[model samples]
Target: MPKPTPETLARMKDVVGPKGFVDDAAEMAPYLVERRELYVGRAAAVLKPATTAEVSAILRIAHETGTAIVPQGGNTGLVGGQIPSGTGEEVVLSLSRMNRVRALDAGNNTLALDAGVTLAAAQTAAEEAGRLFPLSLASEGTCQIGGNLSTNAGGTAVLRYGNARDLVLGLEVVTASGEVWDGMRGLRKDNTGYDLKQLFLGSEGTLGIITGAVLKLFPRPQSLATAFAAVPDVASAVKLLRVADAVSGGMVTAFELVPRIGLEFVVSHVEGASDPLPDVSPWYVLIEMSAGSATAGLDETLEAVLAEGLEQALLSDAVLARSEAQRADFWRLRETLSEVQRLEGGSIKHDVSVPVSAMGAFIARATAEVTRAMPGVRVVAFGHIGDGNVHFNLSQPAGADKAAFLARWGEMNALVHGIVREMGGSISAEHGVGQLKRDEIAATKARVEIETMRALKRALDPKGILNPGKVV
Candidate 1:
């Protein structure tokens, strides 16, 4: 692919106007690098179009000139899908300036907003309207709805409400050809033809640029019951999840797994973090149950579930949050585990998922294999266990060089992913496949499935200018 000509770049800048384009190296630095710093990219410019029309105009120009465009949102992605290429041939089209709350129909339980709206802001908007936007993440404050939609982000609430794709009712996307496809309808049931919005939900900007969305909302919970429990092992934790769901009458909203080592990492690195339980356990499960009615007896349900878990030997110990602050403290441990891992030297992270029945076996086998493969490597396995998605991370051995441990990234991923595949799990669960796992996915995915993805890419983005060299 050829680089965008100076004239083409000029026209692109003119389309966004002065306040929307960034060309200075210093100003573009943040957009070029991701949080993990695994991959750094170079872009000719970063375009921040404030409106759909502006984005359409820019894409129209790029589509005509065949200029590569990368749609970026909040830059909070772990995978390098949002980053431009190292060749400096692409332009980062940022949706940050398009922040807006288009509409909120509380009666219909729908919230429509610009894709650039922060996840936190979207949640706040829904709350102010007496509704709940259930999709959440650790980076909710900085991550944009566009990025969340693009990645199909799955967070703590996914166990109850489903992933990002499930929360969205409609999407307004800018196709690679610069034509705007307005499918932004705030309806619960529409027997429309293709369900086209599903294609871009987790496409990672390879097919189209998501500019606005109509998000599904639910009634805000009037009562919430949170607890931190000590499970003897992962299998016990899974059992506890079943009990929690049964006792709560399917009101269990979040069930997260945290290893003892992960808790130590958080206690050591994060301020105001401490173990909620009295005794140490090999594994911990954070359980949360929410009810829309204030008199739903969530607390009683949780207590009964815990009592049953103890009777069944599923829990060694457990503590229910007596206050909201304590509840927040319990969640802080799970939410901050990803960030605190950085303090523990090099960490090879794998965001994979296995069937709920095989999660324990998969983790045990993967842990044993990785330890045998690389002795002394610390396995900090934890995540949305209710959904069977675990952030199976391996911290470098004590006093080991970070670079050397990181160098074994590919080896570790292969070993872990093999076990995951054997157990009938997905290699990339919450995290989208970006440049990091782009090639490895092709090896694991079925030929027909991979071909189908490629065919879709060709049909939607024939020029291969939208986030090229990333997914597929």
Candidate 2:
């Protein structure tokens, strides 16, 4: 494809009004830098289209000119997916202004929202209608629904609600040729020829730009019980997770694992954060249970499970939040973990997943390997253990040179991702194969899988104009 020229820029400005476009270096600074500060790049312009028609027009112009366009959401992606590439020839197509909740069907428990709607906003809309949109995330307040769908995000709720892909019923997308495919149906069962929505859910804007979507909703939970328990180690956490899953019988909403080091960092760096348990253990698991009926004994169920875990020696200590405020406080500690790590120093983070049965082994092996690779490195491992996804991150040693430590990102990623691949795992679990992991995916994924993805990309976007340089 040819580079974006002055003429193309002028045409783009005309397509998207003056207020919808920006080329100033200062104005584009925030969009250039990624959430993790790991990747940075320049863009020709950042175009904010307020409507899907405007998006279509801008994409049409770019398609005709053979200009690469990067689809950007709230710019809160962890893997630098929303940031432009280093070519400096791409234009960022921001969807922030396209935020809108188009329709809601309470009886059907479905919602149709524009791509720019924030995850938090969607959740609020669901709650107002007495339904639940169970795709919760740490960045729910800032991340757009489009980015979440693009990444196929999985949060603590994934243990019960499944990933973002499962929550989406239909999608309206703009293909590389600027043609909109309206597949927005709220049907629960449609034995069609093929499930095309699945192709775009986690495509990371590679084949097309998702403009709107119809998402599934569930009955709102009337009672919720949250507890924080200290465990002996990763193995014990895994055992407790199984116990909870079995005892709750699908009532278990979330099961998050947090290392002692992670809690220490949160307590020290995040304000008003304190340890959940009176005594600290090597690791902690935040367990949550929810039920739709008001009379459901969620608290009693969780209490009974905790009692059994304690009796069986699977849990070392436990603390159940007594009130809603206390429950929020407990969650605040887990949510602030990434931020606290950022305050500590430069860190190498990995979002990888393996089978639930192999999670304990993966954690042990990865920790040992990372320590051997870089002596004195502090590993801060934590994530949703129930779903087999762990953020096995590493913090630089105290007083170590930040630049030197960060320079080893590739080495660290190789050591960690190699173990994930060997154990039948994914290098980019929920973050999607954005630019950060595009090359790594190409290197690690099976030839057949990669070829299949490339074939789909060609079939949907033969000209390679839709979010170029992303995914396959």
RMSD of each: 0.7, 1.1
**In lDDT terms, how accurate is model 2?**
0.90
lDDT per residue for candidate 1 within 1-472, as digits (tens), equals 6898889989988998999989999999999999999989999999999999999999889888888998999999988999988999899999999899999998899999999999999999999999999998999999999999999999999999999999999999999988999999987788968799999999999999999999999999999999899999898889889888787789999999999999999999999898887888999999999999999998999999999999999998889999989989998999999999999999998999999978899899999999999999999999999999999999999999999999999999999999888888999999999898899999889999999999999999998889999889
Per-residue lDDT value at 272 in model 2: 86
Q: Write the per-residue lDDT of candidate 2 for residues 1-472, one digit (tens) a residue.
A: 6778998898888877899989999999888889888779889999998888888888788878888888989888887778888878888999998899999999999999999999999999999999999999899999999989988999889999999999998999988878888999999999978998999998889888999999999999999999999999888889898888889887899999999999999999888889987886999999999998989988899998899899989998898989999999899989989788978899998999999889889999999999999998999999989889899999998999999999999999999999999999988778776777889988877899999999999998888877777777
For each candidate, the alpha-carbon lDDT, in order, equals: 0.93, 0.90
- Runs of candidate 2 exceeding 4 Å displacement: none
**Candidate 2 collision pairs:** none
- Model 1 alpha-carbon drift over 4 Å, by segment: none
lDDT of 2 at 138: 90
User: Pairs clashing in candidate 1?
Assistant: none
After the best TM-score superposition of candidate 2, give how far the Cα of residue 92 lies from its true spot, in angstroms. Answer: 0.6
